[model samples]
Target: MFKLGSKSDADILKSISPSMKVLSSREAKLILRVMDECIHQIEIVSFFPSLLENPEPFTKSLGENLLRTLKEHQELEERHKCLVLDGSHDQTNSQVALSAKAVQDSFRKIVRILRGTAEALRSKETQCAEDIVKMRDGLCELREIVLERLLTSPGEEKQLREMVLEVSQSHAANQVLIDSLEKDLAMAVKDKDEEQLRSTLQQKEKALQEFVGRTQQDAEKQTHSDQKTSEGKRARLQQEASQLNSQINNLIAANREAEVELRKKKYKEETEIENVIQKYDVEMGEKQTELEEMIKMHETDQTELRELEELYDVLDVEYSQIMEERQKAQELKELQEKELEIQSKAATVIQALWRGFCTRKALKSSAKSKKAKKGKGKKKK
Candidate 1:
């Protein structure tokens, strides 16, 4: 609802919704990731109403959601810290508290903004939003700076300078917080002193009461002990020792009987175990014999298989030779058929030429005979 970065980012924020049904870890995680990327980019400063007359309009619920997202971020950060601190690290593993604390900030301004948004509504909202926006912008810039440093690792001198700047910024922030806390603590000095004094008095009184009770109990016991005699206590102790000796003798007898029983049981168990072992050994021997028989059978089968393979190979070679002979015969038969066809065609051509020659000769003879007959008739006339 805060105009985050782009229209697309805003749409994505709107799209994610909490369900009425209980959400699984996966869904919750997805929602959290989306909120981080989208909400982190929210332009809250520009949306400050008192500051921006034509502010980028946002819903109150949307603003609340923004605060909720920031809270989630803080919680996630705390969890990360816990995980880091409580992780199962080996002896060699260590952390660089100086560099980490120096570079990364505690995000005080953002947290203050969230607190303001939660309780003090409008009066502090503008300032809170401004601070939050500035922090976010600063974070982004810091990320970019780190990214650039990572991309091209500078010389020691340049790196030192950058690191010093970051460290100074964090130190200044921490100093300010310390100063503010000091002021608050100063204001509560009287109450704190009174509370400390009251707590001290109560502790001392309780201790004194416990001491008096112990002393009174001891005094009463001593007075009662004064009335009693040492001889009676000695007699009681002797009686107790006698009873203890009797109990020890009885326990020794019972232990001896138990030991005898345990030995008997152990002997029986050993006998049974031996019998079982012997039975298993017989079965194992029988199985070993069976396995040997199977192995022999397998060897016999292998010999037979080899013989069959040899026979197959011989038959295959003979079959190959027969196929080759058949192929050659078939080729010869095709050649003979071709030769026969060519001879038949040659005979037909020779017969057609001879028949043409004979017909021409007969026609010429008839024509000459007719001409002679015509000449004789004309001479007679």
Candidate 2:
């Protein structure tokens, strides 16, 4: 039964041969129309590495293969152009027409192969770009790890930790999206929905590609901004350090000068103090000599005072003896004056008695004579 089915299919193909030949000719023309497009796509794919900062080996190898294919395609195009030019000369020959048709058929096949190769190269280019982005992400992660190890500031370390956590979350989200897209693709394949399957696949791939591109662009922008900021901070810090060093140098110079001046002042003060002490010592020596002379003079004056006191006592005794002698002489003179007065009064009394006695003697003598005579005269009287 299978053989019969196969035989019937072959018979049906034989009946369609003429129509298929016509269709093939039309397809040939169509292929010609698309040939330039395929070549342009190949060219675009071959040039893709130019946009990359660091292309991988796979991309380089694929680009080389694309270049080789493009060169072959160009050679084939040149041959086709030559054949078209020669077609006029062979216009009368059926054999030449058959050969030309065969050549066209071969060119169509080659064009198809080049188109497939170009598509493959384009897919590879996209994949290469994705891989490069992944590698850059890995390097960034490593850099973060190294920075975490080297970082001392708590704020910067915390910022880096948060960034790492965010990157991890984003990666997880991407993984979940990929898994969901893959499941949808599996479901589409199981249902044999070619259109839906193709569209879903294209959408997923485009979304993923766009997401990767956006991620790369954002990362690059952030890295560039961070680099600019770090450079500015470093320059400012260097300027501040320079200023501080200059200020420190100035302060050190000032301190040294102040120390020198202090030392000079201290020495001058010490010298002045020593001179004052020496002057005081000289005055003290002079005062000590004067005190010693005053003490000697005081001792001599004390001895003279003792001698004067003795002389005063002797003079007092002599004055008392002279006063006693004066009293005795005055008593002697008063007694002599009284004796002289007594002698004078006795002499006057003696003289008066003598005169009376003499008178009495004379009178008696005369009375006796007169008695003799007056007995006669009798009294002569």
Candidate 3:
């Protein structure tokens, strides 16, 4: 509901998020064809966390693509993490292996997640939505800049917001290219990464500076144009629509001319798809030959999840016991410390009383000796 950026989080979630997938007849067939590949890719993608840690084997774009795939895969895994097995689907036998059907039943949600993720990857609107996050980061920097310059005017602040948005705008991701000329860094001493990265930064900096230089001129033009009346805007829109309609007509005519060619292309594609399906059927059948009953994958993950939960419970109980023991030990130490303090105080008081008694005895003995000496002197007199 909050309108901080172009798309609110709730709206973006609604737009990009996939609903729960049911196993439709067409999708079920498609799943059977690609079931083996799905399992293989899922297992391989499990190691993607490591690839994400070290994406040196691929380009930045490929790395990002891999990350998106892994996230969908993780979501797919989440659907299978239930305590009870979902064996609700009727045992309908089809050309697809029984095992594949089982997997489909357990993971009916996979196709939707993958389709949604793939669609998001392809769409520019999704990318623009992602830029909102980058813009939010830029907003933090803007705040810091404003706080640094306490005397910023309203006009300056508006310009700063525009500047931040411009900076935060997504640029092309082509920083890393395999350089055959440069020696392998693994073999040689590693130079500064910034030194290698500086070229890309410099290019982007130059582009940003040029854009900033042109913006004021462009703004002045836009300001003048924005003064146009509603009638003028409607006229301009009508003219643009007319030009677009003519372009569409030309495209339609060209498409009609290519109809026969398109049919041929479609036939070829169908042949290729059938061939691939035959190959995949053989491969998938062999791999899933042992798997007859459905939800083996789900059961395996469920078992693992249960084991982990049990382990966590055991660890938690042990931790609680240790904490209890530690508390008892601490209480005992405090009790001993209090006892030692009481003993020390008692010893101090006893020593003070003993010292006072010794002083009094010495004083009384000195006074008696003085009195006896005075008596002897008086008798002599």
Off by over 4 Å in 1: 1-265, 349-381
C-alpha lDDT values of all predictions: 0.64, 0.66, 0.60
TM per candidate comes to 0.33, 0.25, 0.26
Candidate 1 vs 3: which has more lDDT:
1
lDDT of 3 by residue, 1-381 (tens): 112345445654543333424334564446444644444344333333443344444334344654565455454444443312444654334523544545464344434434434323333122223445455455555644433343344555565566446434421111122242245764354556667678879999999999998998998888778867666989999999999999999999999879979999999999999999999999999778647434687788899999999999999999999999999999999999999999999999999999999999999999999999999999999
Query: What's the ranking of the predictions by lDDT, best on top?
Result: 2, 1, 3
Best by TM-score: 1
Per-residue lDDT of candidate 2, residues 1-381 (tens digit):
012222345554443233222223454456444554544544543434442323353345455554554445455556655666776656555655665666566544445445544545455535335655555556556644433343324554564466556557766777788899999999978778887788999999999999999999999999999999999999999999999999999999999999999999999999999999999999999999999999899989989988998998998899888888888888888888888888888888988989999999999999899779858775546
What is the total number of backbone clashes in candidate 1?
0
lDDT comparison, 1 vs 2, better candidate: 2
Model 1: per-residue lDDT, tens digit, 1-381? 122222354443333322223333565546545544444444433333332232223235336555554455455566556546775653222344532442244343444454444333333445445567677777666655433333332354364465556557766777788899889998799788999999999999999999999999999998888758676888899999999999999999999999999999999999999999999999999999999999999999999999999999999999999999999999999999899899888888888878887888899999999999999999999
Reference-based TM-score, model 3:
0.26
Better of 1 and 2 by TM-score: 1
Per-prediction CA RMSD (Å): 21.5, 57.0, 45.9
